[model samples]
Target: MKNKLAIIGGGASGLIAAIAAARNNPSLPVTLFERNTRVGKKILVTGNGRCNLTNTDLTEYHYHGEDVGFVSVALSSFGLEKTLEFFADIGLLTKAEGNEIYPYSLQAGTVLDLLRAECDKRSVEILCDQYITSLKKINNQFIINDIAFDSVIVACGGKASPHLGTDGSSYQLLTDFGHTLTELYPVITQIKTETDYVKQLKGIKIEAVAEIVAANLTRTCIGEVLFTEYGLSGPAILDLSRIAATNTQNSPVIHIDTMPEYSRDEITAILTKKANKQNGTLEELLTGILNKRLGQVLLKYAGFDLKYEISLLSYKEIKKISAAIKQFSFKVTGVKGFQNAPVTAGGIRTKDFNNTTMESKLCPGLYATGEILDIDGDCGGWNLQWAWSSGYLAGKSAAEKLKNGDKND
Candidate 1:
């Protein structure tokens, strides 16, 4: 008799795993279950509908976890090159924008449609709206939603976007099955500040570098920073918000350098020259150089008169203003919750699963992958790459083990 396999969660990772498993053994029965009436709701919204399918640069530095060695193994086994090849083989051409890879058609729906079509072509069964409330090892078979299978793979994602159907319900279910989970938190989220400067600068966008220093590490990211009524957002701010949100000590302070490429002395010299040539007020001189409201606020914070002419300013005052502009700092009071987060920071601990196959070390015939695992990558397509790589390995490995009649308990 052919072995029966069941995959829970019908998102990106679950669908990939089902397709891969069926491809390995066409006669084996593979069933996919999703809680929502439809699958791939999250995939449709990724990359603003363009779907950053994967990152061409898949490096260890882009991911975070307690078990770095385990993650390294997984990446080496199925890296970015392999992912590109796999999709191309399935008739989905991909293109790279900077470091992010997207479908050639530039529509996320194309990727989703191809995967769904592949599943159909392989005769994989998909059952939507089948919410799996529990999982148990009955005798020797795995049980999910009262259905028994010889093996099961859990691909339920994290709780970052609740509307995407990954509301973190799998964490409790896995814990009940003797798996350990790290304290979950929001990653790639926006930060909120106590000051009202954000409201004043709302709708203004600028390029800046955001630096976050913690007890043991300091990181920096350079990108577009956007002002919202609540606080700071955009790529640069979200990159550092994860660290700030996870720190349990004092609230994290972020330093923003609006002029990242220029030195403080260089900026000062330019400002002095412009002020001397124009004979204009501080506010007037900096009006077009920076955001008008931000310039006024910085001048106020530095105890400089916005109406003062450049020639009237003392050398010491000029130095102080330059320093403030170079090292603008703010304390992050809190981070936006999972509702706005791009990914969850924690999930099933890596210790419970084999990094090679994503199979449960504690429970044979059980596996976990995707955001359900503790592994989370940085913003640029790393998380989706993890989903594809892990899903491929898990599905193929499970099928091979069952085909060989290897049932070690």
Candidate 2:
């Protein structure tokens, strides 16, 4: 008898899993169930709609979780080459910007459309708005809402972007099946800080080095930093947010180096020279060096009067001003939560599942993949790569098991 495969959650992993299963075993009937109005709704928001497909620097260093190295087996099994090849086989033309990969069309919708079309071509049944709340296993066969299946793959995603339909419900489903979850946190999100000045600097974007200081550890990232009313956002903050989210109790502080190009002494010397050369106000001293408002705020923060004459400023005052600009620190309060997070930091533990095949070691015929697993990658298309790799492995492995009539495991 030919086996039937049931895949839960029609997001990135589930969609690719359906395609992989159907291709692995032509006789196996694949059914994809989604809770949202349609599959791949979350894909539309990834990479700001550009959908970063994958990265050339695909390694365990870019990913974070309890056992960051747990991703090795899956990535080695279906690494970046296989992921790009899979997309290319499905007619996806891709382009790379340095290490980041995106579709040639540069539209996330194109990626989704091609994935959905391939699933259709493979005759994978896609049932939209079909939310599976529970699963039952009887004699090694899984049943979802009275429908029996030889194997099941849960790709329900994580708690991030709840509106897109994966609100961390899959954790409970796995819990019912004797699986345990790690402490969940929101990553790739904006951070909230306890500073009133950020309100005044709202909408101001600048390129700087953002560092997180907590637990006696320092993590540094360089990119754009956008000041919001509550705190900070942008590529740099988003990357540093993982540390803030994980180390909230350690009183994490974010130190932004607004002027990364120049040393504190160099900036002080430049300011001293400007103060000696120009008879302008203190604000004019930093006129072309930094944003007018930011300069004013820094002057005030450095205990300097904005209306003070620049030529009359002393060298000691100049050094203080440079210090303030180089190490602007904020006490991190918390993150924006899962709703605003791009990816969740934790999920079902990896030890419960086999890394090579993405199958549950405890429950033989059950599998889990994507953000639903406790493996979350960094920004720049790393998370999606995990989704694709793990999903494909789960799908292909499940099909292989069914082809061998190992359903009664």
Candidate 3:
């Protein structure tokens, strides 16, 4: 009789892990268990349903963790070319938008469909809504709800978007088995600031430079910035959120350059040149130069009297307004939280696993992959790539071990 291989969760990692296992070892019986009624609920919402599958510019610099270098092993295992080839093998062609890769069909559901079809074709058992709240390892057999499996892969994900099925429910499984889970925080999410200025400028979007200053480190990301009733969001915010989330104890401050195109002196010169009250109100001075609402907010915050005509600005006020345009700083109060976060920052510590195989160092025949592991990447397709890369290694290694006749302890 063949021993059964059990995989927990059915997200990106579990799905691909199942495929890799079944495809690599056709004789092995692979079973995936998901608590949700369906799998890939989180994948459906990735990249706004367009599903940024993987990044073309694959590198370790894009990822974050206690040791970002840990991802190199897994990423190099599947690699970018192999990942794209794997997707193509499934009959789903992809297109590259800049460095981000998306399906040719441009629907997240299509990616999920291909993965599910492959699982079905390979006969990988998928048990949906069969959420076993807990499990026990008895003699190298994972006893879950009374059924035993020779091997187990825990890819149940971290505590991001709990509604999609992960509430850190399985984190305890690792801890129970002697794995340490670091602090987890919602990453790649919107940030809230300590200012009422956002209230009036809500819904305004613009191309600006978002900079985060924390722990003696300053990083900048240039992209679209969205002003929300609570604070800031959009590409710029999402890109810098991980850094902010990781350094929250340091009280990170976010600074936005409303006019990144111009230097401080250049802006001051422009203000001096346009300082003509005869033209219109102070608000009118910034017309056509910035978002109407954003310009008004900046003008008001610059300590200039709104009633003052554009041409009547004093030398002191002109310099102050120019400085404000170049650097609109906001104290980051906090992130939008896990509910709004697309993924988490910290999870099961990487030191506890063999980076080469993603198997737990504490347990034999017990593996982990995806966000559940202490690996996260930038807002683009990096996280998904990590999932694919790590899953490939885990599935391949687990099946190979089984085929090599590693007996159940």
How big is the positional error of residue 111 in model 3, measured in Å on the Cα after superposition? 0.3
In candidate 3, stretches whose alpha carbon ends up further than 4 angstroms from where it belongs are 276-278
- TM-score ranking from best candidate downward: 2, 3, 1
What digit string (tens of lDDT, one per residue) describes model 2 on residues 1-409?
5689999999999999999999999889999999988999999888999999899999899999888888998899889999999999999999999899999999999999999999999999999989899898997689987988989999999998898997887788788989999999999899999767788789999999999999887889998999999999999999888889889889999999999999999998888888888986887778898998888888887888888988777788888999999998899999998988889998999988888889998888899999998999999999999999999999999999899887546
Highest TM-score against the true fold, candidate? 2
* Cα lDDT for residue 243, candidate 1: 85
Per-model TM-score, in order, reads 0.96, 0.98, 0.97
Point out the higher-scoring one by lDDT: 1 or 2. 2
Query: Higher-lDDT candidate among 1 and 3?
Result: 3
State the C-alpha lDDT per candidate: 0.84, 0.91, 0.89
Model 1 regions more than 4 Å off: none
Candidate 3 residue lDDT tens string, 1-409 = 6877889999999999999999889999999999999999999999999999999889998998898899998888798999999999999999999999999889999999999999999999999988867878887788887888888899989999999988888898788888888889898899888758988988889899999998897889999999898889999888888767778788999989999999999988877877743477886788777888788899888877778876666888888998899889888888889987889888999898888888878888899999998888888899999999999899998998899988744
